[model samples]
Target: MTANRRPVIVGVDGSPAGLGAVRWAADEAVRHGKPLRITHALGVPGPFEQPFEQVVDEHDIALDAATEARGWYPGLHITTSTWHGSPAHVLVEESRHASLVVVGSRRTGGFRSLLVGSVGLQLAARAYCPVLIVHNAERWAAPESPLPRQPIVVGFDGSAHSDFAVGLAFSEAATRGVELVAVRAWREQARRWGRGADLTRLAAAVRDALAADLEPWQAKYPTVPVGLRAVRGTAAPVLLAEGSDALMVVLGPRGRGGLDDVRLGSVTQQVLDHASIPVLIAQHA
Candidate 1:
């Protein structure tokens, strides 16, 4: 399929979190003018034969999610499917044909509430398309409701992947008619030696680098109000603090020091684990 025709895919597991993901996916499909694909993974069978009834139940999960989405977005085009594999694997395969994949950050218990599920983490690391992990789904407004005038926060460190992230963030901000906050974090060894002047110079250089990186995107998206933040700290903490009330946090799958062997970067993983708002992991097709 063409890129514009690629569907917005969402995985459902019959849980409240899964249903919430369906709602978010529906709204996104409408916004992008793409079809919505609601799917359920039946999971890999064990040593013993899987029950036929379990397959039927899984099919029902996908159908129910489609029904819920249709009710909320009556005009949106949607499709439903069921696959026999792990949720992460199935969604990763589906991502090959999708524009975006969305799932909920299902909180199972106390500590888990602060982290995304195994499937979400896996998709963030491996999906071919961007993966969106929706958090605090209960507060997500209706499709026609106006979004808060919060900015879309994006982390950029001049890596090729982060450059793509900056572009995506600008598109999202423009689409929502909101501001775009581009944050670049740096570590200053001078601070440890109490060298105030050196630290000031370092901060200035970093800010100039960030501005240069953002120059082209700002020109391309002239209407998107851009805010630049050059902070002296680690990426994850700075992003989480700045995006506390953001519409969503956009990030690359990896960063400047990311190894080719590593599918996900440490900073992205840290933010995904703790972000209370939606997190979008940008991927190159």
Candidate 2:
């Protein structure tokens, strides 16, 4: 991303969630001194019998909303576009070279207020740069008041997807100039608890591997402060604690679990459900 040209991209469709995203994104562009590129993704229900412009009525409204919100950031460089495709696809593809991507959370069903939507999951899974899944509008509008507190942190397991998440976290820390933390969650069932000696060796191995994975990043961004820890707990609690006061959390979408959810990385999903801050997931590429 060029220092003078790269813009912050946002996805919108005029939902309350989308409005929250626009409002948050406007501030982000100003904070970073980056242009805001607002995009609206639309779709056609049937055959393409009419012009592309006729189907995406939502984009017009989104454009209007973005225009009106620009008042909050009078100096921000803003642009708008309308695309026709999956929200995840359109937004993620557009963010390929973006400094950062921001989007709002979808409402959870009934009382499932903490739930995340399939599109948010898909974007987080696929986006290469930092993606902030804005869930709480009231909180984010005043982001600078008190944020970027590191807690409930998580670390990658060295797969490509996890590496992408690492890069995401690294960029976030670099941007904020805060400590980028790394965590490896551990769980030992009764079957393995008996071998106390073996446990010691296993713990050592996890430690060694984590150091190796973080080496390249540490060296590349030497000035970016870092903290490394291997926790003996489940993914949810560890992540929640690590991500506390976190501006954004990063995770990966692994596979389907016993339940019917399309995205099976429940740890990340659960974090999204409960956390007040933003969550970004990197799915298998």
Candidate 3:
């Protein structure tokens, strides 16, 4: 399928948080003019095979999610499906054809749950498309209410992954008509630099680097009011603080400092665990 036509996929598990993801996915679909797909994964059955009742329950969960999403967008082009596999594996496969995959921050059960245990991490690290984890899905209950007019915050450190993240962040901010805040975090070596003039030069250098990285995106999205912040601290903490009131926090799967063998970066993992708002892991297109 064409990139613009790829559907926005949401995994549901009959939980309040899952339903919230439906709402967010529906809005995203409308915002970007894409179809919405509501899915449920019924983990691989035992040797005895799956029971009829269990299959029926899973089907109902998918349908219920679709119904709720339709209520929010009556004209939405949407579909529902059920798969037999681990939640992470099923969604990762689906992500191959999806524009974005969304899930709730919490789940109630094991079979169909998306965020329980290592499922969320797996999807973040392995999905072919971007993965969005919606925190506090209950807050999205009302479809007519406007999202907060807060800025969208993104972190970049000149990695290929972060470059994709910055592009996605600019697109999101442009769509929402909000400011885009691009942040870069750095650490100073106390042994090499003194407190006065050295620290001042370091801050300026960091700012210049950030601005250079953002120049192309700024030209592409001229209307998106941009803010550059170069802070001296850890990536995770700086991002968490900068995005405390943001509409959402956007990050790469891994940063420049991330080891080549690691699937998910430590900073990305830390932000996912502590951020109160939605977090999106940008996928390389």
Candidate 4:
């Protein structure tokens, strides 16, 4: 791997989800023509002291993941590293120099009800680079033949954070030669003085605002076809449904309606927790 080029990093922990992340990351590295870096975290010691053999077993796990990735992309440049720290910390640090960090929606958990794993949640909120969470790699597996281009969905709320998300989404769509769908979801508030007509007018205003916000990005990526969707509903459900067939869903850490004190916005949290497709959280450059 070249020293200057930023590799796409993926965390592996020998779980089914970890394998899914590996496959998705390998495809991304190939699509972007970048190097692939597979990482496994040998977490800090806790109450239970691990035997020497167990530590060696961890190394074996990482090695197996690297081997599997190589099988998928024989010509791609692949590198593997093991970090001695928490998975979240190690991956977050790796994100500092990575073009993108791809991970599974959830890892091995005792409870089957756990939707998104803790490591994924931490990285979504704190990663330095864009974090891509692949929920179902099997459904998103790379096709052997060239398939029709899928659109990239971006949840736009006309906020500063959405600005970054728009930029990233446009770039990805342009690179992949795919369509970009910029969505803005709104909800009508009950008014004491007005009737149902007032709510309809408000919805129209939100739609117009969404179109205006997306105009600049459309102009910037003229080669990339753009689709503007403004609907009356919650942002999370709208984005989730739109992203069902998209290549990936892009969102900001916060939206226009996000609380200032919260690290992760409500819309982002909901999508990250429930979206079945890959979700990309766009952070500041």
Candidate 5:
């Protein structure tokens, strides 16, 4: 295992979803050639004190998770830690020094009740670095495995936040030696649209803007093949549908202006809540 500045941090518990996160994180760590840090957050036990054996059991579960990931990536550097704090807070703090933070889609509850767990949501909203939420089940059939040419789908709307997302997506695609799919969704403004108005010009403009936004990135990552798509209608649904065959979906939180509820944009939230593949939320520096 080689020492590196930024390690891949993952929140791990004994649950199946947690182990899936560990596996996904390990794969990413290998891709990035960075160390893997597996973390377990132990919340305070209730008034009824837990037996000594139970305490040991909890630690063992975390240890086992780390061991599994280490075994899978023999040459990868791996470390494990248990912190006494809430899972979201602990993982968020860990993200400060990590290149990326990974978490399970669901934890400790009936799966049908929620599409994503609360902890995963909190971390995605607050983590300093990129946050990846890995779903346990594969919801789409990929035309090929996530190698050689898997596409990294990014949502772009020409905003600064979207710019950040595009940059990250380009880097990830370049790193994996894969293609980058930049999608921009547009719709005619009802106020500007008249009956039987021609939308051809509007569609062309949207497509051109998307290409312009991607031009610099294309130059920066010459080896990465990029495909720009200007789709009609809402951004969320378009990106979600594209997630069907993507290795991962990269998106930025909605821009912060004009509205108090813009901390995490609704479109980004929708994709995070429903993306079948791992979703990486690119945070603003």
Candidate 6:
């Protein structure tokens, strides 16, 4: 993998959130024996707005992130790139063949604007590689401490891509000595008679079916703390609500159901919206 692609890619905006992304990218780059490349997009100014200094500022931030990464890992190579386009478009385009793309959610606008800003949301949905959205510092980190331990929550629906997500989640859990939580969600099912779907039972049955698929993995990783939860509700909301303190979040490239599944099961899409955390998206589903 090292020989075939860019080592690590992170977006920088100089905000605390962006710096947090740089921090995580540096750690991964150092641990994997890979270089760190930082990129920032020179966003076009809104109509009639030609902020020439914006480009220079964006460049400076990218370079700053590169310097920070190199400082963390002296042996870790560093490269920087600047593109004149939409941030999300440029980042996702560059992420096509890179190891991973990391970004931070900093609201240039208001509160709701931060949830899934333009660049972060687009990358989360369209990036060809994994997109990590850095939010807080474990909700409990020193001013200059290494990242803290948190559960690695993986979203699954039984497809091959979902399988890859599970494997990635397990690998991360094993590597980090952290807990792993796997959650599967389904639409509430209707009961007999002229009744609507039982959302509660639907969540349970879906959870049970998904739990069964995890049996072999459970046997193989007996010592790794694992929990399976099948919940009733939308996947994005459930995962988002539960992953607040999670070390990282992962999603299958698609879903298990089919066209409808992929279209609807895109918690990854919604997860990136205004979310603050690291996310991994497998290529298969």
State which candidate has the highest TM-score: 3
lDDT (C-alpha) at residue 214 in model 1: 95
Tens-digit per-residue lDDT, 142-187, candidate 5: 2132322469999988888878888889988987888899998888
TM-score of 5: 0.86
- The numbered model that scores best in lDDT is 3
Off by over 4 Å in 3: 45-54, 107-112, 142-146, 192-197
By lDDT rank, best first, the candidates go 3, 1, 4, 5, 6, 2
Q: What order do you get sorting by TM-score, best first? A: 3, 1, 5, 4, 6, 2
Model 3 Cα RMSD, 1 decimal: 2.2
The 10 consecutive residues of candidate 3 with the worst lDDT sum are: 106-115
Q: Candidate 5 at 101: error in angstroms?
A: 0.4
| lDDT (Cα, 0-100) at 272 in candidate 3 | 86
| Candidate 2 worst ten-residue window by lDDT | 107-116
Clashing pairs in 1: none
Q: Report, for every candidate in turn, its global Cα lDDT versus the true structure.
A: 0.84, 0.67, 0.87, 0.80, 0.76, 0.69
Once fitted onto the true fold, the runs of candidate 4 whose alpha carbons sit more than 4 angstroms away are: 1-4, 46-56, 106-116, 138-149, 198-201, 257-261
Show model 6 residue runs off by greater than 4 Å: 1-5, 44-58, 109-116, 136-145, 194-208, 215-223, 258-266, 274-276, 283-285
Error of 5 at 240 (Å): 1.0
Per-candidate TM equals 0.89, 0.70, 0.92, 0.84, 0.86, 0.76
* Per-model C-alpha RMSD: 3.3, 5.4, 2.2, 3.6, 4.1, 4.9
Per-residue accuracy of model 3 over 132-166 as CA lDDT, tens digit each: 88877756756665556799999999999999999
Which candidate, 4 or 6, would have the higher lDDT against the true structure? 4
Q: What tens digits encode model 1's per-residue C-alpha lDDT throughout 1-285?
A: 999999999987776777777887887899889999998876764432667886677699889888878889899999999886778888999999999999887556232221237778889999999988987554553445443568999999999999989888998888788999999999965455543557678888998999998999999999999998898888999999999999899999999988988999999999988998899999755
Query: lDDT per residue, candidate 2, 22-129, as tens digits?
Result: 776776677677889888766432354766676566558567756756766777778888765667777778877787777887555222221236666667656656
